[model samples]
Target: MSNISIIGLGGVARAIGARAIEGGNAVEVIGRDAAKAKDLAAALGGGATAGTFGATPVGDLVVLAVPYAGAVPVIAQYGDALAGKVVIDVSNTSNADATGLVTPDGTSGAQEIAKAVPASAHVVKAFNTVFGHILAQGGPLDVLFAGDDARAKASVSAFIESLGLRPLDAGGLEVARWLEGTGLLMISLARHGVGNFNFSLGVDLPG
Candidate 1:
């Protein structure tokens, strides 16, 4: 079991923490609000703990479950503390209206986050495609991820499998831009065509 540190106490963070705990991984929750983090950890149970916001994470894998804007500051604040660790970027660069990516065409949220961290810190983009509600269900769903680090991707893939979810590698860290686009597309579909939030984007293989 892996020790996972989640850097938020919001819905996404809570969902990931709950699933990690269910998969028998040690969970440490950190957020700007210490009381909220402690409360979330208490609610999660399963021996989960609350961690300091700016401290080095106790887990081998640290998930940045906060919004895209929030993630950048967290990465900067953590700095060398995240060295030699797998930092999972679950943030998307979508605008508030879900119209387009907030980041420029050549860069992505994950790639930018990677640039802010130490060299030894492996940044992998995962879990940005799925919504919090779908993740909480702990179900058979596809999770697309991208990163330059193979080992980090493999570790994330293993963790996804442990949660009974399928992990699909979408090339290197540059592909994270596409993943964020997929997130925007999914949101647009949900708002217009799909007309509901009970669905997820997935790939279909030939029979």
Candidate 2:
């Protein structure tokens, strides 16, 4: 089992925490508010513990469950603590109204995070296309991820499979830009005739 540290206490964090526990991985919840982190840990009730924010995370894999804007600051605060660890970026860098991406062309939130962290830190982008409600409901979903580090992507892919979900490798870190755009597209589709946030983006592969 993998040691997973999720940095945030929002619905996404909580949902991922629950799934991690169910996957038999040790989970640590870290947040800006100590009380909220502890409460979430207790609510998870699967040997999950509350960890201090800006401290070295206990998990080998750290999931940034915060918004796109908050990710860089968190990475800076973690600093060298994240070195040699796989940091998963789950933030979607989109406009305020979700009409388009906020990041400039040829750049992505994961790529920016990768540049901000220490050299040894392996940054991988995943779960941006999936919603919290879908995860909480325990459905089988395809989690698309991209990273320049092969070992790091393998580690994350193993964790994804542990949760009974499919892991789709969308190529190297450069692909994160398209992954973020896919998130925006999902949002747009949900708001239109899809009419719900319960769906997830996936491929219909041949059997």
Candidate 3:
């Protein structure tokens, strides 16, 4: 099992921390509010612990569970602390109404975040397509991920599997834009086509 450090105190952070702990990975919860981070870590149990905000994470795999707007700022704050770490960007760069992406025309939120991190650090886009509650509920969910580094993707794939989920690589980091678009599509589906938020986007294979 991989040592995991999750940045955020939201539903997404809670879900990932819980699953990571359940998978026997060491979990460290980090947030701006130290008390809340401790509370969340305590709540998670299973040897979960709280980490100092803006500090070098104790885990090789760092999960950035913050919203898209906060992603870059948080990375900036962490600075060189994230060097050599496989950073997982789990944020969606969608507008408030979920009408479209907030990222620039060509680049994605993940790609933009990648630019902010250290040269040695790798950014892998993932978990943006899944709802926190559904993930918390636990099941064999398909997690689509994109990253430029093969080694980083492999590490993330193993981490996803540790959470009882399947990891599907959606090509290089350049593909993150499409993944973000897919995230927006999921929201639109929930509000219009699907009429609810309890469902997840997935694939069906011909067996």
Would you estimate the TM-scores of all the predictions?
0.97, 0.98, 0.99
Over the stretch 62-82, how does candidate 3's per-residue lDDT look in tens digits? Answer: 999999999999999999999
Instruction: Identify the candidate with maximal TM-score.
Output: 3
What tens-digit string does per-residue lDDT give for candidate 2 at 44-68? 9889999999899999999999999
Output candidate 3 Cα RMSD. 0.6
- Which consecutive 10 residues in model 1 have the weakest lDDT in total? 157-166
Which pairs, if any, clash in model 2?
Answer: none
Candidate 1 lDDT over 28-89, as tens digits, reads: 99999999999999999999999998899999999999899888888998888998999999
Count of steric clashes across candidates, in order: 0, 0, 0
Candidate 2 ranges with C-alpha deviation above 4 Å: none
lDDT values of the candidates? 0.91, 0.94, 0.95
Model 1 accuracy (lDDT, Cα): 0.91
